[model samples]
Target: MVKAAAVVIVVVGALGYYVWDYNTSPTGGKAKSEASASAAAEEAKTHDPEVGDCVKVADPQGEPLPTVVDCNSPQAEYKMGEMLPGTQLECASQYDYGIQYHNSRGFDYTLCFTKV
Candidate 1:
């Protein structure tokens, strides 16, 4: 019947619209996936602090808030060298090792080094 044919057309049209919308949406389908991938890459870069990374520690005795600085600057407290395990350890030499930790939260690591 004509009504039955009309119903089928309507249903198909609705489905097509939804498919197009999903693909175009910024927070769904391909767009969303690409955005997430970009975010993850940036997060990895932030977490993986490398050697020769200059940082400024606010509190020496308390939990260190190390803000990465230019190694050439006088304010730069430490230049990161090694990646270590756990939270506690002793540096072998006077020029100590800097630690960059990765967790659910943002940069939460200790930079152990003598003053610059």
Candidate 2:
């Protein structure tokens, strides 16, 4: 009987803690769920490269995925000149480098870059 009573007391204590925590929390136990969803949505937003932005190339030999960086930073190697939609591109002679990005979903674009 004593062991059964101890187990019941432990279970009751756990339940009491849960009730207190839920009542004291501002969102009543929904804060974590709501915050996680909000954070996921924010992270899903994509960054679009624009003209005049300084970009860094991780490797010229590999597939290009230029990321924007401060022009004054050592990692920045090129200055974006033109951004055109689609794969068919004719970058002007002034641009020193050009990269064509092909999106399998059909939203392709080309980026013209000049040496920084």
lDDT (C-alpha, whole model) for all candidates: 0.66, 0.81
Instruction: Compose the digit string of candidate 1's lDDT tens values, residues 1-116.
Output: 99999999999999998899889887768888898899998865653446667777666556545666777888777777655454565454765544544567654444455455
Q: Compared with the true structure, what per-residue lDDT tens digits does model 2 show for residues 55-113?
A: 88766667877777889999889999998888797788999888888877989888889
Backbone clash numbers for all candidates listed: 0, 0
Give model 2's TM-score versus the native structure: 0.60
Off by over 4 Å in 2: 1-47
Residue-level error in angstroms, candidate 2, position 115: 0.6
Model 2 pairs in collision: none
Model 1 quality (TM-score): 0.51
